[model samples]
Target: MWNHFDTNGTPRTNNNLEGYNLKLNIHLSIASADIFKLISKLKIEEVDASLKYFRSAKNEKPPTRNKLYVINDAILLNQKQG
Candidate 1:
């Protein structure tokens, strides 16, 4: 039911979310972390997200995507246009 045809320059997959989940899992380092530990990690993520938001708000350019992704995006754009 999801359509990304008109959503140019946006991700077409959940890879980013999956990557974040993997990172969080590694940081937790346990199958079942204590509630307090989970809360602390969540707070850290919140602060990191806030910092990125503020930086973007100040007109700072975000980090570039990987070269592979850049190429893939170009190809997809060409396909969409043609």
Candidate 2:
């Protein structure tokens, strides 16, 4: 098991993720979803969590995009070269 805390010293748990799953199940109870679609939904939710900090009522601009782009570019370049 991984044990780590956020910058504010709050411990992380699967409770939040479980809640998301529960809600998704409830919402899609009658629907049939494919593996790719489910994975895409989870990935979109992950991106939302990462962007929450940058999304504030007072903040006009978020600085996370450039950083994420740089990291993604490096990974892509590595994959291409290797």
Candidate 3:
């Protein structure tokens, strides 16, 4: 696990990927994971991080109907249906 050394000459671990490695280690510690389980967990965390960032940056609010927009959409939908 230790090949390269950090600037201090201490053998380094996965510090190259600081944030990600920390998260993966936490996941591994919490559960017994095979390679496939590890990959799946990483993928889910990646998506969760991406979505979290997206929502935070965009200030996304909870889904709610705009009454006027909903009514207009319903009218259009009814016309197509009938």
Candidate 4:
């Protein structure tokens, strides 16, 4: 009856991957990653940046935006300024 509540702990990361620095390091240089991995990684990074941009926007105009097109252009401005 309690089976549903029993813990089913699982490793969140691949331990066997520890010895693969050279191999995994390749993932760091997106060019080394295959199309699927590259797209996923880039999409994740973009989503993270977009979330931060909008969260920091906090319903107020980001100063970098300057004028119209602010919403669409803020990310470019932030990138250049950074």
Candidate 5:
């Protein structure tokens, strides 16, 4: 489940989710928010994810990957094929 070599287009790691969690923590700005506030923030996240999904389904490209990651992916692809 952790491997990505045979799974094209799948995330190679949970970096995206980690980044999202970091962003959420920053937005919350509190170590312990009330239940209602937490729910509100989660709803916002859900809406954002849904919008991104729809945009992707419509062929709108998501943000470009970092150049370093792009290069690494290319290298891995070459190694996998060879």
Candidate 6:
């Protein structure tokens, strides 16, 4: 009724569809992870832009209060709200 091979040389259908499903799932999971990372990056950029806009709107001066707090990378921009 059936033909099968075992490790010793029997034949079988045990090399079946289950493994195919697992391979598909692994690929799909990796793609979804990439999408999630892209969304997070977009959100962070949006927040940063919003902060910069409102800070600029007020046209305030940078703190002459502490010279040490300055970061070299900081835009030295952004005014405070009235």
Best by TM-score: 1
lDDT of each: 0.86, 0.61, 0.66, 0.56, 0.85, 0.48
Model 2 ranges with Cα > 4 A deviation = 1-17, 27-32, 56-82
Residues 28-69, model 4: lDDT tens digits: 665456778767867876887798788787975544633644
Candidate 3 lDDT tens digits, 1-82: 1222222323234544797778788878765668887889978988998997898799988467669756755565556556
Ranking by lDDT: 1, 5, 3, 2, 4, 6
Q: Write the per-residue lDDT of candidate 2 for residues 23-47, one digit (tens) a residue.
A: 7787556578777767877887788
Using lDDT as the measure, which candidate wins? 1
Show where candidate 5 strays beyond 4 Å: 1-4
Q: What is the lDDT of residue 18 in candidate 6?
A: 72
The candidate, 3 or 6, that scores higher on TM-score is 3
Q: What range of 10 consecutive residues in model 2 has the weakest lDDT sum?
A: 1-10
lDDT of 6 by residue, 1-82 (tens): 1121112223223443677556545555664567766577667668976887787788866336334334411222222111
The true-versus-predicted C-alpha distance at residue 61 of model 5, in Å, is 1.9
- For model 2 the TM-score comes to 0.35
TM-score between model 4 and native: 0.34
The root-mean-square deviation over C-alpha atoms between each candidate and the true structure, in angstroms, is 2.7, 14.4, 21.8, 18.9, 2.7, 27.7
* Higher-TM-score candidate of 3 and 4: 3
Question: Candidate 2 clash total?
Answer: 0
Q: What is the lDDT of residue 78 in candidate 2?
A: 59
- Model 6 weakest 10-residue run by lDDT: 73-82
Q: Which pairs of residues clash in candidate 2, taking residues 3 or more apart in a chain or in different chains?
A: none
Residue 6's lDDT within candidate 1 is 70
